[model samples]
Target: MDKHHSKYQITQLSAGEEYSIELYPKDEVVKAKYIGQGKLEGFGNQHLFISEGKDKNYIAMNDYWLRKKDDGILTYAPISSFSTLRINKSGLGEMLDSENVHYKNLGLRIIRFLESFGEKFD
Candidate 1:
């Protein structure tokens, strides 16, 4: 992973790599395994990842709001019905919005996982 200030270009995550993510607030972290790049039914091409637990949860790539630009910059947009989470300047995750709890939680987990790889938000 290449770190540029608070921004990170994640070039280290490989297929089948296992990582942990916080699935819910005050809940135990869950294990997620990267299934590599593939096309999601309605989301086109995206990175596939799945979480392991009592029940299998498939996290769609489209749930991610932070995107890497061509200029190697990290940008964010509210892709879901709400903008519920954010990574603060300190590189810690914080919940800023609360309209959609489910998607927000998943987004938070994904962002934090990316942050572990050195990615950041504005």
Candidate 2:
């Protein structure tokens, strides 16, 4: 995902890594790598995502109940369960290598994931 802007270089994403996405607008959107499966607690302003377990501190990103709209928008909603998903690392790598890549939702997800993993494109 190595993206180069006028003054900053974009972070690079790797294959098969789990990440967290921010629900708000900010310079940094992705939260963390998601060490283990986290449980959603509270609601609205009291909502909190907690990651903790005996053997695992967190779970994979896909395992979280995420809602994707018909317009290709993804967001977290009130769901009973979350499913395990897979990321296309090779395809993502190819997109990063090309100059035709559009850094929209998917691109941003990859960038944030890389940033969480401490990858520096700068």
Candidate 3:
């Protein structure tokens, strides 16, 4: 858990795979579709950025493109920047260096902790 990424809620979509801003809305797969990829910007604390089966057309501080699959394949990107981002193994339930976590309720953190699920919404 790093200082920068741990501040926001990470929408971990997959267990073994890592998704980064570099490969998200601007990836080759996305650009191949529209000959351009949308940009994510001008937002902060963008939580639950994108849901399953939905299109990624908006930018937020904390957001996701979409649930790629039921196997947890979500990618996360930090807002407030217009530069390249480093790909790391940050996830939803990762503790923030084990010190700053006291700021957030431990119980709530546990409640928010989920291993995996088939559906992305109700």
Candidate 4:
């Protein structure tokens, strides 16, 4: 996998490869792409999920996960299914209301997960 870095860092993962992303400040827009041959599986059986907000604050974007099928690869990104759960468990919406954009409870979980794998976004 070729690794590149700028405002964001890039790494290529192989098929059935799993990775997590957590952006800092909770307001920064982030993007990701999978390079080379392989399948990329993301959180919640999905490749994308936006955090809790009445309006769109951040957009979680990533390359669609791909798998080999009949000598070809099919790609798709599942919808986010965690937003409502996060709001219910931690009152994430209320927490977001308090902070300008620092970090929230559930947000920290994502950050920690990404950091656990030595990934960071600013």
Off by over 4 Å in 3: 1-47, 50-79, 82-90, 102-122
Clashing pairs in 2: 35-58, 36-58, 36-59, 37-58, 37-59
Candidate 4, overall lDDT?
0.33
Model 4 lDDT per residue over 3-96, tens place: 2112232333452333333333352222233222211222342232333445323323344332222322222222222321211223434554
CA-lDDT, candidates in order: 0.44, 0.35, 0.29, 0.33
lDDT of 2 by residue, 1-122 (tens): 12212222222333344444434333223333433222322111111222223321222334334444333333444322233222344444555666664634454455455445453433
Off by over 4 Å in 4: 1-32, 35-74, 77-103
Q: Which one wins on TM-score?
A: 1
Candidate 1: Cα lDDT at 73: 30
State the displacement of the C-alpha of residue 22, model 3, in Å, after optimal TM-score superposition.
8.4
Question: Which of candidates 2 and 4 is the stronger one according to TM-score?
Answer: 4
Instruction: Please give the ranking of all candidate structures by TM-score, highest first, separated by commas.
Output: 1, 4, 2, 3
lDDT (Cα, tens digit) per residue for candidate 3, span 28-121: 2211111112232332223222211234221222334222223333333342233322211232234433455552343223223211212121
What's the CA error at residue 4 for candidate 3, in Å?
25
Model 2 regions lying over 4 Å from their true place: 1-85, 98-100, 103-105, 119-122
**What is candidate 1's lDDT per residue for 31-102, written digit by digit as tens?**
567665544333454554566555445543443453443453323232232212222323222342545686
For residue 20, model 2's alpha carbon misses the true position, in angstroms, by 19
TM-score of 2: 0.26
Model 2 alpha-carbon miss at residue 29, Å: 29
